[model samples]
Target chain A: MGAHSLLPFTQDRDTAGFFEAAAEGRLVFKACLDCGHALHPPTDHCPRCGGWNTAWKDAKGTGRLHTWTTVMHQIHPDFPAPYTLVVVELDETPEVRLMGRLQGEPELREGMPMEVWFEPLGEGGPVLPQWKPVEA
Target chain B: MTATVIDDELAFAGRDKAAVVGIGQTAFSRDSGRSVLSLATEASLKAIADAGLTVDDIDGIVRCEQDNVRPYSLAAAIGAKNLHYWADTGPGGVAPCMMMGLAMGAVMTGQAKAVLAFRSLNGRSEMRLGGTGRHDAIEVVGGFGSYDEFYLPYGLQSAGQTFALMARRHMLEYGTTAEQLGAVAMACREHANQTPHAQMNGRPMSMDDYLASRMISTPLRMFDFCLESDGACAVVITSAERAKDLAKPPVLIRAVAGGAPQDHRPGMMFPVVSREDMTELGGRQAGAELWRRAGVGPEEMDLAQIYDCFTISVILQLEAYGFCGKGEGGPFAASGALRKGGQLPINTGGGHMSEGYVHGMNHIVQAVRQLRGEADMQIPDAELCMCTGGPLPIGSSVVFRKAA
Candidate 1:
């Protein structure tokens, strides 16, 4: 499937902010308003407190590289082979982690600094979060 | 959270109550050219016959939820006179050992006399589990809830990618190398070379072959993946008293435990970015109960038929199930302790890596063979064997013992 076609289900209320922020070139993650715990992939209720009070906040877009893998062979047409996929711990909430692709070839080391950037799926299409190493 | 330990008295309630009296399987192949119902019927009838019982003796049936062949269809084909109980268990490869637990539950409750638990699939032909399709494309995608919407867009489409991510973390933390992972693949291929029924039987693998193989995902070579095969396997379970009069020696179902992690996320291939430790899995959650119920720890297991969907999976499971300390699996596996006459003979029938992947049904069958003293790489005096489903965060396990 094409990258543009793989957009999130817009009907889901929890992810409404994620798509809006992505369109504006900003990444967002959910945090429970009641317990101050960060959540991922957008959920309605707090996993920790079981409270429905939750809010979306702009992510700090900086974290440390945890681990990653490069798709040596292409499975999806939209994603070419040999692209790096990464797992990063968010700077705002180290307990919360996010998965995305690396934007460019950069030296990878455990706990190295990383920051999120946007990669458009196509011209005027939905953008995706891509992480890269912070300049030394 | 503290691990829940089952007391000795409660553990005996289901311990040695039911026995796997028969096991039958069709030839594993890329294409069977037969309907799934036909495959299920063939395996079911063979298991019934192998147990020296008739279809009328089978009062119940159990299968995986993903199985194309329905329980009622197999019951009808086998001319089961009275189908008292039947159930379809969950997710994917994690159901084989759990199906035994369900079957045993049926027998213990007098819901059925003899229960046939089977897994049949045309994985390569009908359902290319690896085929391209949107997760939300289906109206009701069984157990794979809405979690697919999270990771599928990021090209985390297959189990290989997710496993590679966790394996990379292990490497970073423990300094595990690709060479350690290769040892698992090499060891299974060695077992497959001697296994007459194994598809990869004639083609043995070496460390050189493993190193030269193309990488599918980083650190996960093509050799790490299991073959997509079409086949069916069935095991017949009856009361221990009834199994005493059966055709083959009964392999007693000593213990069974399966549960989700505390997070209880839908595991297989969903985005696990939220997990604190990627290497953590419910295998240990179930493992603790399995050992308690079986009244034996890892050291007492004469052989282990751990799930080997990928080489990394085997390494992780060895550690999760307490066969070795955490971060010690790479060295433990590379030490050749998992081979024949080694510390723990694992996957004697080649495992899913080299054996045809009947999803873990083959593992259970191999465990029965080892306990029966009939395996190709039979370990001497294998009285107890451990078989696991997939080692994902949500998994299942069972302990089988030779009938005294």
Candidate 2:
């Protein structure tokens, strides 16, 4: 961790479960109860079927890199320069993607297999999902 | 799924019914050393004068929601007695053509005879959009939840970074070279070299310069980002009948459409990562409707003022507007087709990349100038110009044609 803290995360009714599950090292997403559609970054209702009822589903923690960027300039004090960010398509739901910081220097390729690891933001900080190449 | 369902009757209602009679803009600069209201007032008065009308003749005002100046403040400054209609539209860079679209609706509906649509901001000195000055965090629980929650923690803060991901994906999928992206920056810079008022006019950029420029985000260089400037731009809109007697020839508002993709996430760039195809933009559906309502295709356009908040934006819009096919924007840009005297010359006034970032307002002003045959890098006999708002998920576009 750097000297600066991560930006504060605010949990609402729709996202409280997501952060709560992260504390237990289990990645979770909201799935529509009616249509079984998965919502990333979770929503109150299903966009496809207009279903209000939803349930939290655990993710497999494995995904493929859809796209990535190595941020060269520092936009925030908390995030120092020369860090890489990746958007990963979950193995269970390819369409449901999540963004996170990529760990270790790896020659990244699209569709490369990766696994998620949780990083505790020091004391009282929110747990964040991070990505790294799957070990051979 | 199409983001917008066009009403057959309403879609065609404003086509050729309203016209842009005047265009005005303040000098593009890193800092204006003046209030936004003063900038708005100067541009609004200039636009009114350019239309061959006095301030009293203006009965309506339309503005971007993000603009620091408000309609009432502008009206008071301009000395307009009574306003018949007033409205604002936004998300900043996406609202120029949409603002004009609203003005067209107000005029066609008889809500106002002459409406002034304007955007004014001290983007550089005050609220630098591409920088961290604006407090990039969001309050998630207070009924104002946004997609920022996902990316802000990981340092994916600026719009440039979000767009960089899209640019990188395009390169991966299509073998788009850095030179191809350089082509867009160079083309806009060349146009700026011709445009006396462009902020980058004296400073020409070469491909080597573009390549050598330090990277802000992986594939996106400093040159790839748009200039953050302090400026204001305004246009006067009126009924087609009234346009005939104006000081300048009328540029008919052929068509206007604004919409987002079906999976468009609420908060601009952050949610875009979750979109199915990162290479695609809202321009796909919006462009289809634009051409449909105008009864014209991309081939009919004399030029395009595609919003260039970044070099990639122009590339995406080129593909979105059907100037070329999908996954072909890189090669299309590299073909030297966007420069003056080439096929589909774009941003003849230098655009956001070279001219200034007035949140796409300058693009509209440039389109009007090209159609009027008054652009510094004018395309000879330019009759039709297409100005697109955001290449973002939620965006708008308009087709302007010189009245026959």
> Using DockQ as the measure, which candidate wins?
2
Q: Which stretches of candidate 2 lie over 4 Å from their true place?
A: A4-6, A103-106, B1-7, B134-143
DockQ scores of the candidates:
0.44, 0.54
By TM-score, how accurate is candidate 1? 0.93
- Across residues A34-127, which tens digit of lDDT does each residue of candidate 2 receive? 9888887678888878888989998999999999888888877767778888999999996688887854334788999989998777676677
Candidate 1, pairs of clashing residues: none
Clashes of each: 0, 0
Q: Please, what are the lDDT tens digits per residue for candidate 2 over residues B1-404?
A: 24756579887888899999988889989999999999999999899999999888899999988888889999998899978799989777788889888899888888999999999999998888886674434322222366565677777778899899999999898988889888998889999999999999999888889999998888899999999999999999999999999899999999998768757765656778888888878888788888999999999898999899888888888988899998899899999999998898988878899999999999999999989899898899999999999777586899999999
**What's the iRMSD of model 2?**
3.5
Over B1-404, each residue of candidate 1 has an lDDT whose tens digit, in order, gives: 24567477866799999999988899999899998888888988888998999998999999999898888989998799889899988668899989989999999989999999998888877776654433333121112245554566676767888888988988988999989999989889999988999989999888989999999888789998888889999999999999999899999999999866655443345646567778877887888878878889999899899999899999988988899999999999999998887898899989898888888899988999899898887889989999999876487999999999
Per-candidate TM-score against the hidden true structure = 0.93, 0.96
Give, for candidate 1 chain B, the lowest lDDT window spanning 10 residues. B135-144
Docking class of 1: acceptable
